[model samples]
Target: MGVVEADEADRPVSSIVLIEPANRADLPAIVSILARETLLGVRDSADPGAFPDYERAFEEIVADPRTTLYVARLEGQVVGTFQLIFFRALLRHGALLAHAEAVQVDPEVRGHGVGRAMMDFAIAEARRRGAGSLQLASNKQRLDAHRFYERAGFEKRLDGFKIDLSGH
Candidate 1:
């Protein structure tokens, strides 16, 4: 999950590259990555071709001060994405907290450090934004993902359970 320096600063960075506050133009690629991963995990996800109208969501998030999206690019192709949502909580000295959600790396880019780079960027972004704490949720069955998070200094501190509301 560590960043590997390139021979030239201007040269294309390898494995993992992070770009923050992705625009609506990036949603199609991000949706593709999510759909692919969801299919691999056997989750009832929307079809890649039917990812819906994300123009409004993207515009809203990009315009909002409390939200950000980090896109992982490999060899100039967007291969993964994650979102950070910031909120204020009274318990933490009235400081901002950031939560990372919907993290996904393309199957082709998995194990190549893309996910790690994206997370590293998110953590730095949270710090830059004056967030007092950074958190993320991972499913219990994703052992590999959990291990990766652990290696990156995350701890399994909370258990979250949920039931679907879509009534599928």
Candidate 2:
């Protein structure tokens, strides 16, 4: 789904456009932002051309109805990106849950509320989709990100465990 909305802050806020299902053209910028994260950066190439497999994966994700790859733009330039996945589970009364992943904002615009707008969009979209909850998982090393999420109204509700099946 495609959408555009003005900043709704009662106080002044910078302009940011959140696009659901981010297009292929935004890949390079998205990669750049992902490369800025201390933990994720070590595993990222930052240059999309270096990874053909990512292109294939991106295509698959784009075709999947349950996922949306969001790209945040400012002044027509892509600055941030994330993936939101919708799932239904027996828990929460089988309500659909919105899970966000790989959220990243350009280092150049880190303190400009760009991440806030992206997250606001994710939360709003989850509500729009009748989701029971909106959630995201941050790396244990991302203390700053945890603080940011808390400031954005997220809580430390559960402990998450993951198996490294990728074996990287």
Candidate 3:
């Protein structure tokens, strides 16, 4: 995708955000954003020792045909990141569903429309790929994030549930 200039009346006139497929070099910035800016920060690490694991995970994500890791860059600096995964769901009559995860925007750029641009890109990509709908689950504790999503046109339609399997 090409760069999207922030034209919202409330956004800075000079902001130009680019959303693109993440490469190996972007992993560090991506990891930093996730570890420092999100609700999952406590569970994520930006330590050197943790990087190899992130690298491996990045490789795996890119290798999977149905998944993609994307980064939002402002003037060549990574400022946001998200992962989009597509899957066919039996419950929706085998509809193609796009699930977005790990969406994080650097605090410095929060009000600059970077997140909006990223969500716009995600929605367009999902539609282009024939997905019936795009869905995402934000942790219940993230009230601000929920508001952001709602502002992006996502509705709180269904209650989401999860189970930790790391102990198994």
Model 1, residue 35: distance off in Å is 0.4
Q: 30-114 in candidate 1: lDDT tens per residue?
A: 7777767753465523464445546556777788877777787666688778889999999867889999998898888677676
TM-score of each: 0.82, 0.87, 0.94
- Assess the local accuracy of residue 45 in candidate 3 as a C-alpha lDDT between 0 and 100: 85
| Structure candidate 1, residue pairs in collision | none
Model 3, residue 92: distance off in Å is 2.9
Q: Quantify all predictions' global Cα lDDT against the true fold.
A: 0.74, 0.80, 0.90
Model 2 weakest 10-residue run by lDDT: 2-11
By TM-score, the candidates rank as: 3, 2, 1
Q: Which has the better TM-score: candidate 2, or candidate 3?
A: 3
Off by over 4 Å in 1: 1-16, 39-49
Off by over 4 Å in 3: 38-41
lDDT of 3 at 63: 100
> After superposition on all CA atoms, how large is the RMSD of candidate 3?
1.6
Candidate 3 lDDT by residue in tens digits, 49-151: 9899999999999999999999999989999999999999997789999999989998888878888889989999999999999999989888988898999
Stretch of 10 with least lDDT, candidate 1: 1-10
After best superposition, candidate 3 residue 35: deviation in angstroms? Answer: 0.9
